[model samples]
Target: MLLEIDAQSQTPIYQQICNQLIIGIATNKLQPGEILPSVRQMADEIGVNMMTVSKAYTLLKNDGYILTDRRNGTMVAAKQSLDPPFQARFSRELELLLAEASIHQISETMIQEKIKQIYQKFE
Candidate 1:
């Protein structure tokens, strides 16, 4: 897996890692049961603090994107569907995004088309 981090960006390194990994899972670049690099290994590979990678992995774990066990270390999780809390969180985030787009004067049609394009990526 490849992760690109921009030191100058507004987003934190941990969040950048989380975003990319989530994208990878959604796009099937990372598959269920596939092993992920350990926090130390990922830190060494990407030249970041181990804690940062650990935080990203922790967030993914909390969000149900990954699994951890003594035998497996860390791996992608096979989520059958979104649970209630997750669905609510996603709805709120999407609502905020749409609000921000409207604030920027992005048209409804454009927002919908962009949404469609993103949905297609998951498919």
Candidate 2:
């Protein structure tokens, strides 16, 4: 897995690590069941304290993005359908998005068109 850290950013080091790892997983750059580097190894490679990497790993495990076992170390968790709390949180985020879209008089069609245009460009 590849990670880039901006030491100058306002975000905390641990949060940056966590966010990058989450994005990597979501993008399929880091596959499910793939083992992650150990905290001490990552900390040494990233030139950060072991506590920082440990914090990020703990947060990821707590959030169900990773699984940890004494023998297996840490690996990405299998993707599961969203639970009730996750579904509710997603709905809340969508509601906020719709509200913002309405503020600009944006319609569903406009959103779809923009998405298609961006998708084609990426392709």
Q: Which candidate number would show the highest TM-score if scored against the true structure?
A: 1
Q: List model 1 lDDT by residue over 1-123, tens digit each.
A: 889999899999999999999999999999999999999999999999999999999999998899988787999999558589888988999899989998999999998898899999999
Count of backbone collisions within predicted model 2: 0
Local accuracy of candidate 2 as per-residue lDDT tens digits, 42-78: 8988889999999999999988999999899999998
Model 1 lDDT at residue 112: 85
Worst 10 residues of 1 by lDDT: 78-87
Each prediction's Cα RMSD?
1.0, 3.5
Instruction: State every prediction's TM-score relative to the real structure.
Output: 0.95, 0.75
Candidate of highest lDDT: 1
